[model samples]
Target: MVHKGNCHTQAVCAVATHLPARIHVILKEDRAYELRDLEGRPISKKDAKALIQREYTVPEEIRQRTRGHKKRRRRKEGYIRSQIRGLVTALQASRFA
Candidate 1:
């Protein structure tokens, strides 16, 4: 189960039991429980918060987009080929010149 108290205080606790072998494991992991980030580097809470904000925070414009909305059109194969041909011609011209 996931228990979230505040933005900075979130924990995931799992209770596992093996009846046959009589094995029980109680795991309680929290974001702030460890003073290290996913990369295993030591980081302060403020630094962690800043890193999370920089990576996970979404832009307001993207957030306002409707679900299932087509934001961009896919490039056609012909268009891509033409662009590549143009680039190749330009490169050749530059090389010859």
Candidate 2:
């Protein structure tokens, strides 16, 4: 009696090669560049958003709508931020110890 077949064995030790990542710092949001346009003043949020949409492949309408929403929401974003903070603290403690 062959108890372990190809299906069972593959399922038991599935090695994910390229798992999708859930957390990422959007590049534009993460970095700031001196805006020489609009008379050397800081870029308006609206303008900054437009530039981001133009530079990146993101859809325009969605980007505009998402401006008010925080990346760190209490229901979803908050939980992820807490997890990241915990990991960072653990890493720091390990390094010091």
Candidate 3:
């Protein structure tokens, strides 16, 4: 049984085997980049920009429409963000430890 939260883990892990030993980082709400490892540890920003520049895939941008009467978009955006956060948390967990 797969949980919705860790959906990204399956994808990330599957690709991990094929990917080179590259560092993974995520953009935080504060517009800062942080290491996306098993501990959410901090890393030097010196090489972080290079990684971003070399990224192959870019995530789609999301925005809420203030003029829309329907709230579906807002709810969907929230749900997507929640799922992403859950995936990050799952990735940070130590399987061996």
TM-score for every candidate vs. truth? 0.33, 0.25, 0.27
Question: With candidate 2 superimposed using the best TM-score fit, by how many Å does residue 22's alpha carbon deviate from the native?
Answer: 46
Clashes of each: 0, 0, 0
Off by over 4 Å in 3: 1-70
User: In candidate 2, what are the lDDT values of residues 1-97, reduced to their tens digit?
Assistant: 0122223345334533222221122343565544434356678677867765565333545544453354535557778888999999999999999
Candidate 1, 1-97: lDDT as tens digits: 1122222222111222333232222133322334557788989999899877776565445444522243332345567889999999999999999
lDDT of 2: 0.53
Candidate 2 stretches with Cα past 4 Å from truth are 1-73
TM-score, cand. 2: 0.25
Arrange candidates by TM-score, descending.
1, 3, 2
